[model samples]
Each structure stands twice: as C-alpha cells, then as structure tokens.
Target: MTEIQAGLTVCTVLVVPYIVQAIKTKAMTGNVARWIAISVSTLCGVLTAMAGGMPTDASAWVTSIFAAVGGVQVAYAAFRSVGVTDKWLDALLALGDIKED
Candidate 1:
C-alpha cells in the first residue's frame, strides 16, 4: 500500500461503518454496530500495514511495518483529536482480528 492507499483506507474507515449503521439501523443493534466498527478499524490498520510492503517482497518486513506504523499512528492521533476514541475506537486494536502472515 502507498500513502494513497492509506488515505483511502482512512476515508473508508471514517465513512463505511456509519453508512452501515445507518442503513441497517433497524436490524443492527448496538453490539452489531460496535463489531462492524471494530472490523473496519482492524482492516484499515492492516491496509496501512501493507504500506510497509509484503513479507515475500522484503527481508526487512519488520522495518517496513515499523515505517508504516507511523501512518496509522497519525491517523489515530487525528481520531483522538476529534474525540473518536471513546469505547469503540479505543478498543479498535484490542478487538482487531487481522493476523500478520
């Protein structure tokens, strides 16, 4: 993933969950919406991590992940600035289901 990809991921994370919540509100309970937000957050983190590059392509995969980590850090910082870190965003990583391979 490049910076563009990271930016797109940020936008998707910012928008998709709310859209999902809104469209499915009648059938979607609080717990379901919470899980949807968690899932999108986890996927965005993974997308950003790919900015570090894939393992097969780089021997310095750890370093790449490190480099790309800052992008996610900054994104979370913005989220924090906007007070998006209450229950859902705060638990985003703790509930992340993505696994590095």
Candidate 2:
C-alpha cells in the first residue's frame, strides 16, 4: 500500500475502537445513539487532522478543519451530557447552593 493509505489505515484502526468503547459504556444516561454519534464525530476530528497533513491534497486543509470543528462541538456536548464538569465550576456552583435544601 502507499504511505498515505497505510497511515490512514493505521489511524483508522486506532480510532475506531475508542469510538466503539465509548458507545459500549453505560456510565452516561440520555440517548445512547447520541453518544455513538459523538464518538464518530470525534473520529472525524482525527481524520481531519490526518487528512489536513496530506501533501497531495490542498482542499483537505480547509475541509478537514471544518470537520474537526464539528467534531469538537459533538465532543463537548458529549462531555457535558456525561457530567464531566470542571472542578472550579463545580465549586462555584456549590457556593451558591445549600447543603440541605
């Protein structure tokens, strides 16, 4: 196989399992399908970065970046749905709340 093709294959092998596992885990609630979509979207981000670096294609540079941004949006939403909050934010929210209310 060509170098670029080989590289893309390797990257796909590495990313697909992560996406599968993220969907397999049931730690989060809400829509399971949405989590699967998020995982694929994140994979698209990986694809975008890889595609962006190809020397043969100039269009990939622009298109891949947009795909990456969409992936980022999905990933952020996934994190938010899973309760993956920042410590500072949690602390700030706690300050305005009561222990027993």
Candidate 3:
C-alpha cells in the first residue's frame, strides 16, 4: 500500500473504533455504531483505492470497500473493553448544527 493508504489504514483500523465508541456513549445506539463502522470502512476503502491510484470512480470505490472491509473495520465487541466516550463528540456535532435524536 502507498504511504497514504497505509496511514489511513492504521487510522481506520485503530482509531475509528475509539471514536465510534465515544459516539455510542454520547448516546448513539448499537445500530448506529454498526452503521458508523460500515461508513468509516467504506470511506477508508475509497480513500485507499484513490491512494493506490485505482480509477477515481464508483466501481473502484466499491472494489476497495470490499477489500478493505477485512482490514479496516475492527469488531466493536473485540475492542469494547474500555469506554472512551466523551463530550468532544457533542461539541463536534454542535458545530455542524446537529442535535441528538
């Protein structure tokens, strides 16, 4: 993988789950967390594909998402041993004018 791809892979694989859990504790549900994982994995894969210099098109994005699903998304239960949720996420959402449901 290219440096960008490798780096993004690390962030998606290692850091995203922590953020997701933080969101969960911020009141996002298990279903929300699951979808968040899917969304982040898809984003990582698309960026990975772009970094890898694959075609900058939907087909390539789809291919990359499938491929990266194995490496990018760490299981929620596998790493849910700690709770790191915080108020930072609330501030982040507020910046976007998003209110919790």
Task: Name the best candidate (by lDDT).
Answer: 3
Query: What are the lDDT figures for the candidates, one per model?
Result: 0.53, 0.49, 0.64
Better of 2 and 3 by lDDT: 3
> Alpha-carbon error at 43 in model 3, in Å?
1.1
- lDDT by residue for model 1 (22-84), tens: 444457786686556555555655555565454465434443343334444455456556766
TM-score ranking, best first:
3, 1, 2
Top-TM-score structure, candidate number: 3
Write down the worst ten-residue block by lDDT for model 2: 16-25
Q: What order do candidates take by lDDT, descending?
A: 3, 1, 2
lDDT of 3: 0.64
Q: After the best TM-score superposition of candidate 2, give how far the Cα of residue 97 lies from its true spot, in angstroms.
A: 21
